[model samples]
Target chain A: MKKDHIRELVVLSGKGGTGKTSISASFAVLAGKAVLTDCDVDAADLHLLLRPEVEQRHAFFSGNEAVIRQQDCTGCGTCLDICRFKAINTTGASYQVDPVACEGCGVCVRFCPASAIDFPKRNCGEWMVSTTRCGPMVHAHLGIAAENSGKLVSTVREQAWCIAVDKRIPLIISDGPPGIGCPVIASMSGVSLALVVTEPTVSGLHDLQRVLALARHFSVPAAVCVNKWDINPGQTERIEAAARSAGAEVTGRIRYDRSVTQAQHQQKAVVELTTAAADDIRLVWKQTAAML
Target chain B: MVAKTHGRAARIAIASGKGGTGKTTVSLNLAAMFGAPVQLADCDVEEPNLNLFLRCEQLTSTPVTMLIPEVDANRCTGCGACGELCQFRGIVSLGTRALVFPELCHGCGGCIRVCPSGAISENPHQIGTISVGQSRTIRLVEGRLEVGVSSVSPVIRAVHQQLRDDMPAILDAPPGTSCPVTATLLGADYVLLVTDPTPFGLHDLKLAVATARTLNLPCGVVINRAGEDQVGLYQYCQAEALPVLLSLPDDRQIAEITSRGDLVAHVLPEYGLMFTELADKLQQEVLKVAGGRA
Candidate 1:
């Protein structure tokens, strides 16, 4: 399946829970040997379905966090006064750095008169390369309350690309995080095509508009697929119309189906099921593949 | 649970480790059923939408700005101290002058503090906007992050500033167990976790609960779309002694009205008592936790 131009397709939803991960999983199944990646490192759930077996693991160190050495004890509040994130705790006799709140800005480290603060590499998360039923996959686990998700996303995307090249897969399908923020931008930056999976709802439409704008802002070619379109036909039509007007390809629509859940329960992709939802998702893949 | 307030008004943050598990739906309904004035802050700054549902006509919006280092070129020295001090490369002294990339700056004021030449200063950079409005019993303050801004903490803090100490506040946190969610949940009395009753729900709920614990915030669960509890979401709650406050049915009608941006508590009377009970349970838990601390 190797090609001169390796197509990277990232499935994104500006809003969450609109069948983003499920459809991305199905796309991996349809592609048969594509390199799969989940950019939603904070809550990476794609592994639930694909069940990737870890092959290579890498520690993701992004930025630096300040650690106050209690023994250095000048008890000066210089670090506390200059801190903007409220990360410094001035309780007891000395100050302590609340690792959860520290943004690792190095401001507190630089200004401490006693120079008691130690700037250390922050292990924000971990990204891993694995083998899934679909194909080779890459995923990550972000430490609880960790920052630098955007950096971790970028790392995962690179690992996915490397795997795609090594495995000679022509396509890489990424399950992007839900939001049009840093992580979302990092995932979709230079993709060949992006499939914006959205439900037909007011908040859905509202977030969709923002996502489309983000795609346009970065010049990423985007296609739209309405999940559970039957729940709100009028809103579906409106969303499709909006997508068309926004110069995005309205690829297809999927009706809400219990089989989707059943497939999830069995740790399988929906397209593996002989159900209406499976058929609709296959059509979506067909059209989406064409766009790529 | 730094206890942002002492028996004043509890800040209840509705959060989920996974997205689209009905955090917004639960927070809005909880506010509606509070039976008193409550502040609903949409701290999901990237995809803010409580305003979409509330549809408040009169909104006063103010841009949120963070102070980034601005070097005074005329101060006449590429001391390189500012560059050496900044780890983010926000301001790198190229031997001749310090280049300022405001976007990369975390607004930590380190470069300004470490500058020996006293050249580095602070400049406000707009990251987002906060809009204040009112809807029935809820005072809505929504944060909208300007596209292209990477950090949401500054914007989330701005939204929290609008929380009234006199009224109970419900924070609609962004999904995931990351810094953004922490920024929204910090200093809250209790965290109301909304989750679906499935593997993904339970799995991420574990992460969400861990996050709540990391902040030392007491939290309970509301299982969205609960069925026979096949996935052990209930068992997990029971095992951990985390109270299962409420279990919602997998009703398409509820989804129908909710997707249309209508409050189910208002549109469907049957669900009104459900929310009232949810509110009461939340209040009771808050009171119990407060009393234990006392």
Candidate 2:
């Protein structure tokens, strides 16, 4: 899926709330005509900043869900004993499926003696093709307590790629989810460059290394930027050293600024304002743009 | 509401829809303020850093495994039934035999039932490990998911499996309104959502509130980084009827101490009262809800 024409840059952080969305929104504004995507489907906050207007919406379906026909169910406790997910609830005369707990393994559906279980496609969430003041964008809202975030992330990326190709967009800016897990990996594939936003702390350093290792494992080139580097100068230096040792480019450092919050309150990217952090983000964009 | 099995131990889960909204900070502080007889569970298994600040002495560690199918080729009939029934494609019939992928398996056991030859059996596949430790009076239980493992619910369930019936537990839920957060909130008596006053915090907090409502759990909000500019968030909370249980200051001193991995309650001393008050309020809520259990 690697394209020679478009440069897709993904903003990621192993830890959450490290300004990934803030930085990505700035990059979108800077890129101007790029295709934007919010890969953080679990707790998507990019749309709050971009304020995209939805033009098209698509239903997302992934995996199967089990529903018991209560009228036909015999309350035999057979599915309860067989389910490992603890999804089957017997608090009533007839067994009920706790949709949140049910992983939809379909084990109970197959084992039911009366064949009372129904296996249906799970409507996990919805993905949208929208238009922001910046440009065409893609985002999604994952159903509450629903699984398959990784799948939803993939779906968003796929639609973004299609829109980019269709529109002949030369760039893509994505806001990625936190953690070094499945959803994070799903966002990494076919990405041209990864900008890892991190803060200055022990947990930040610990998680940054693990995420760097994941990037190395996937052979995805990554650049690390320490957000709020002034808060802990010592830890910031240590993190930069680690990023260097891990063969990643230490791109830029942003100070902890109140203007970042002010910008958020206005639903604008920090780069759109006159602030020290905006200058720092511009330098990051300059460096990242050169690499791309 | 589920009935409490043991004598008076309220399970309070501190969760956030947005990442880095102080779920860990709140959970750790409340556990310290609760002062012993409390179980601090780190259900955020993917990148568990509670051990970073807790610094407890390790007691025991156990691997959490999911049952995946191991096909016995010797007894195989190659009927392709296993592949046909598997929704996850964890097991596939390749030409003459069935191949099983442990990582892909949901451990549903459907393939085993579908196989006419009775060739499939289940084996334990390690996904994560649960470790128990003690920090002064509070017992710490943290779940660490294996690096490559995708399924986090099993590891979360393993951490909860270590919860004691008699002692109160403060669960540090992973950020987001997805399945993992839901898994942590399910058995809790009350959910304390910690959020900042920023617009991003308000936006994500709405999602978390919807999730708690969908799960039918009684919950309240704690606004971190509280500032005068929080009229937007305050109004939303008022409109939603979500109680603001506590609000921490938007002070630089708090951030410096917190980011340095110090429990604000222990280091600042005066701020300990906030957590103490939070504990008393949650205790009343738990007691009130315990009586109305199904």
Candidate 3:
């Protein structure tokens, strides 16, 4: 059933503090020969869990930030006045820079009185193609407070897909960002399937709806799984019902266990931890494989 | 007819720019220490986890809806006025008809506002549900936006409608500095930013701080998983002149307790006293702000 161009992507919850890195790592191990990509560039933690052996690294420029030449600024202040990002600030006789406020928009480059402003492609982050025990993993790190996570996710996913094709693999299991935002949307574009892993809580249910809706919008087949279902049976049932109502397949319900943490503490997958959680995870992986 | 104001209480929202920074833990514990017949609103409608930490009885919930413009083709003039009026650019004009991207529509009614003809009619779009519940001490209200609904601001606004006077109120806000967080922070007396000690934590913590400063609200941080990540958070706070109100260390027992769907304060009795102290410090800060405003 392996297709030349098919790939499977998974998105974790938006509610951080969830054990997404650990769970994704487990899935990676189960996926053995498949290429993996960590698309949570804004806060990529799968690298921490997988300990990927980075083979190649490169600077990634998502867009351009307007850089002003001080000598040519002329103290006219037109660039400062028109910039929506307020990246440019006028001092007594000169100007100052506020990189945090800069959205990398080029309004200042066009409006500069002395034509001193130069728009350079902003180096937002670094992308890497690395080797993990599971497979070749594509991941990236977005610089502190830098936006363009959507672009980074797309970049890594594209590379991951390309690598899978080159390797003649059938699957590219991508770890997507949480929420129904731009990064999550980017993670879903053209994927054969998206497995949405969520928890059994109020916010979990709320975010699940949004993420699922996003999957529906993209016309991608989606499957849902509630991690730590034992903690809240009522909420878990509700999530299951919600998923069913939306025509999404509920792949598996994972019970809460201390082994998940123990596995993380030992730097191993839950399936290797020899616990009920591990058993549940193996079954979940089986379901994922069936999807493929 | 205009209804009474009912002397509703001021809502102080607790928010962060990133998730899992302990927003719900801080917000719920804050309500617990306020010790009055207070109302706690979880405005993170997309994920209302505030209820997970609180024991609530007697819940009343309602479905919240937003307007999705449905154009009547019979009366439509194809003047392109609706598409032109849409600020979000969600409306796509075809040669003879128009398509609407419901996700991008902010429900601002701007398109309807500008339409010369009476072709554009508002259709009810059920985005989420708002619920009211009661713990032993405080009343709880939360909004759960229907999954896949793009706009959460309206659901947040609905949660805000449950504000009550005569007691302190805490609004647990969703992470991010987007429209939903803005709606939750509106008219709040104070904003407490919960954060952690990692690189991403500090990065997003600054965003929440900037957002709070821009809104002119008194803000502070409650560092969750304190020890290993403290340096980054502390440095940022000192540089920004933001106070580090409290620190919750990386305690495995606490983590296990939370994993069991119990708030750390509930499982660790000692943290109850800590939350009380945090509340006392916050009250002093809130009073100072109020005095200045007067």
Per-residue lDDT of B104 in model 1: 75
Please provide, for model 2 over A1-292, each residue's C-alpha lDDT reduced to its tens digit, 9 standing for 90 to 100.
3367888899999889999999999999888789999999888989988999999999988888999998999989999998877788886687899888888878888889999999999998999999998889999988988884588998899898898888888888999989988889999987888989999988999999999999998889999999999988989999999999999999999999999988888889999999999999999998888878
Q: Which candidate order results from sorting by lDDT in descending order? A: 1, 2, 3
Per-candidate TM equals: 0.96, 0.95, 0.67
DockQ values of all predictions: 0.76, 0.71, 0.12
- Computed on C-alpha atoms, the DockQ of candidate 1 is 0.76
- Candidate 1 on A182-281: residue-level lDDT in tens? 7888999999998999999998898898899989999999999999999899999999999999989999999988778778888899998899999999
lDDT of 3 by residue, A18-119 (tens): 656667788888877878888877657676557789999989986566677887778888766765444567668898556555555354665566889877
Candidate 2 chain B lDDT trough over 10 residues, lowest sum:
B1-10
Candidate 1 docking classification: medium
Q: On DockQ, who's better, 2 or 3?
A: 2
The segments of candidate 1 whose C-alpha lies over 4 angstroms from its true place after superposition are: A1-3
Kindly give the stretch of ten consecutive residues in candidate 3 chain B with the minimal lDDT sum.
B1-10
Choose 1 or 3, whichever is better by DockQ. Answer: 1
lDDT of residue A108 for candidate 2: 88
